[model samples]
Target: MVKVKNLTDKEYLYGHKACPGCGLGTIGRLALKILGERTIVALPASCMSTVTTQYPQMNYSVPSLTMAFAGTGAVLTGMSAGLKAQGITDVHVLGLAGDGGTADIGLQALSGAVERGDDFIYICYDNEAYMNTGVQRSSLTPIGANTTNSPSGTASYGEKKPKKNLFEIMIAHRIPYAATASSAYPYDFMNKMEKAKSIRGPRFIHIMCPCPTGWGFASDLTVEIGKLAVETGMWYLAEYENGKVRMNVISKTLKPVEEYLIKQRRFRHLTEDTIKLIREHRDSEWRIIRERWVLSKC
Candidate 1:
């Protein structure tokens, strides 16, 4: 681990209300550590909001403004404008929201913020679903994965579609930067945050944070599962910067998706055929992304 001359004390103090082994809380703490006290986080209605609530003593040491479930992106933009108008350009601005908040309900506001080139970082601590909302399925949920709303029992299918191409979408907007990060790799996450802070226009980081309660795995396995997702190629480490796509974390050795999925009760009912389909989907997606990235480089 690289040593920082001045790493801020954990802005999110101990004795918080997050569930045991909640990767989000731990990673959130690490993120704030990197951002220091000068950063202003615009949070939304998610599990994170609870951590920042008045009752929790607002774990966020720096000032935090809570927004509606779907207004994080817009609110961050407004905050940036207000601060810049006051000639206060030193503080780092961040919008921290969950996958459900970022990928589904808050998407339009997110897109608007990026398109307007808002000078801030929007970081989605993606736990794959609306964990705060009883584990309902969200667009960030992987295909063939089960959720309370996207049950395997089927109104139709288990997360029938693939995780939305959020990085690509950000590319479509030609934002200055967009990338993915995982709690399993704190340094990577922190590095992305630092990079985004230096950039002028809109920047986004999709951070994978595991939910022990919702994923039906042992609380201690949160970090393991997150690392496994990347190893299995189910989640690719990628980024889009200045309209160019690149794979940031390339998994030279692929692990079986089954290794990643079988431990979770959510995928307990997945049949061999379904598992195979998921494997194929992941491989094909990886190929598509890699090919495009390579050609673009050429």
Candidate 2:
């Protein structure tokens, strides 16, 4: 069993409007704990925005600003600049967005921010699809998974293309730091956030947050599913620094992808050939990662 650090005093308050076993809320709490009170979060039009702040009541202890769905990156850039002008170097500026907000609508702004070497942390809590908009298929949705927009039937299999490799895309920008995290591994997530806090230039962390409602899993199995994803090699945890990549220790050993896919109802309709295809793709990706890891050592 993985040991997670106990954070009994929740930075994300107990009474939020998130669904049961929602990994996004857990991610918010863990991130807030690491970021502390001296942090400003720029939230996009994601579930995090609605659940944390509704009408007059807000659950967050730290300052948060909501922006347009496609403007979180720009907002963070502005916040970072403003703080720098005021000589307020201690406070961390963070941008939080969902997969759709990050990978699709907000991609341009994000690319611009990273290209300019903005001093801020950008986090994308990817639940694999547009969960906030009724489980529509987004660019980040994995192939053969059933979302509302990518339903499987006799004529069509789920998402036709594989999930977008956002981490690789960020790495191509040659930013100071980039990492892939999972909500199941709170220690790893917190550690990465703490490290990003100390870094100077553009840093990005993509966290895989399993959604119980969207993924058609037991409400209580969010963390379990997240762990299985990493264990089964469906999700790879790694960090990129100074043009080098290193896979996390926990993700070095992996189980079969079937173990992970079988649990989620989204992948239930996948045919044997489709499963094999996914496995092949996963192995190929791992090989590329391994190559990168080896090159990082030299």
Candidate 3:
């Protein structure tokens, strides 16, 4: 078991609007804690923006900038440049966005920033779909997940496509650091964020945050669901550095996918065939990841 230190006195403050058991809030807290007070957070239009910056009071202890849904990466690049011009080399720039903002609408700006090799860290807290926008389906929504847009009725299955290979996308950009993280493993998440802070180029962390309202799970199952995701190999914990890939020790041994699927109501109405399809997809992806790990050893 990985013992994570308590960060109750960190950057995240009390009195926020996030739903009970929302992992996005946990992600924000842990990430900010690791990035430290000198960090400037850039949030695109997402759940974090709404909950963290409610009128009259803000939950974030550090400075935060709210931007358009597709402007996070671009704005962060500018912020980093501005800080550099002002001779503020010690401050870190952190960009926070949802799956919709990062994988879909914000992909262009993010790509541009990464291609330019901006000095900042972009963290995408993916709750699977556009949870902040009525639980709509986003490209990152996993196959067989029943979102409002991808309803699993007799006429059609849930999401037709598999979750976007976001990690690979980031790696393809040749960023200095890229990793997968989850609120279930706070220590690993914090360690990755801290590592990204130490690096001087563009870094990316894709966090699989669980949403109680969107996934139709009990509000308290956020952490449990996140754990199940890692245990089942649905969400792997891995990092890419210096042209090599390394899987986290805990995620090497995976449990059955069913154990993770059955816990979320989004997959409750899935047919046996759909479950098999999901398993096949998960296994195939795992195989590819294993192959990459092997290559990294060469």
Candidate 4:
């Protein structure tokens, strides 16, 4: 178990231009504290990339590459291979991408890298929409969340599709490690990163990062909103490894889905009927989780 005290005091990621209360910003800093300076990171054309890679002033203290929107996995693979070719093993290769990059455009590249069993860590910080590109809907965007492309109106109801099952999709590849994390739960996320760091093959961590600017929430409420998402079962914490699954934060009873949804401007347009439907879907998902995943007694 990793405590806050166990983390390094050095700031490997800092002085970025991320919006105030940005969950992605917190994730970058905390992840670097865990991964340390001995890492080479690849980022796609997303918010993190735009904010961290200003000319003549890189926010990332470690070696970092700003890759094309769809080339994160490929870049990481090449970096790892090049390092290994040089007999370098002490450094880690990491890919930091947003939902748009991970679940949509970069999916093919990621699939190839994982299939090749590349030694790297790919962390997708999901803000639930194409935030870096004007809040357009992405495949990982949840049902009933209003976006530029999925607006709530007379004939529309925000995004019509459920959030894609990205964790399971990655798990199907049977990578050495995969975990779902939340920005609200730093200890759990840190411990998972530590575990992934010690592993040798493909690793994935999907973090539910709430966006204050994109999600229409107050900046100060970022952590609260993230916690509410988990508490209400809109998101969960779990891991898949060695052909098994474990639920990291299991709750016998979930808070009302409305409690989580109503706070965000994206979901505020949802009516009672839609909220009911959302609750039903959440219940169904939880049933599947409880039946299939090994519940860790936390």
Lowest lDDT 10-mer window, candidate 4? 245-254
Worst 10 residues of 2 by lDDT: 1-10
> Which stretches of candidate 3 lie above 4 Å from their native place?
1-8, 249-253, 294-298
Residue 233 displacement in candidate 4 (angstroms): 0.4
Instruction: Name the runs in model 1 displaced over 4 angstroms.
Output: 1-6, 10-14, 54-56, 154-157, 294-298
Indicate which candidate wins on TM-score: 4
Better of 1 and 3 by TM-score: 3
The number of the candidate with the highest lDDT is 4
* Residue-pair clashes per candidate: 0, 0, 0, 0
The weakest ten consecutive residues by lDDT in model 3 span 1-10
| lDDT accuracy of residue 190 in candidate 2 | 83
Which TM-score value belongs to model 3?
0.94
State each model's CA lDDT, in order: 0.81, 0.87, 0.87, 0.92
Error of 3 at 270 (Å): 0.6
Candidate 4, residue 221: lDDT: 98
lDDT of 2 by residue, 60-109 (tens): 87788988999988998899999999989888888889999999999999
**lDDT string, candidate 3, 108-173, tens digits:** 999999999989999999999988878999999999999898999999888999999899999898
- Which model is ahead, 1 or 2, in terms of TM-score? 2
Candidate 3's displacement at residue 222, Å, is 1.2
TM-score of each: 0.93, 0.94, 0.94, 0.98
Candidate 1 has which clashing residue pairs, if any? none
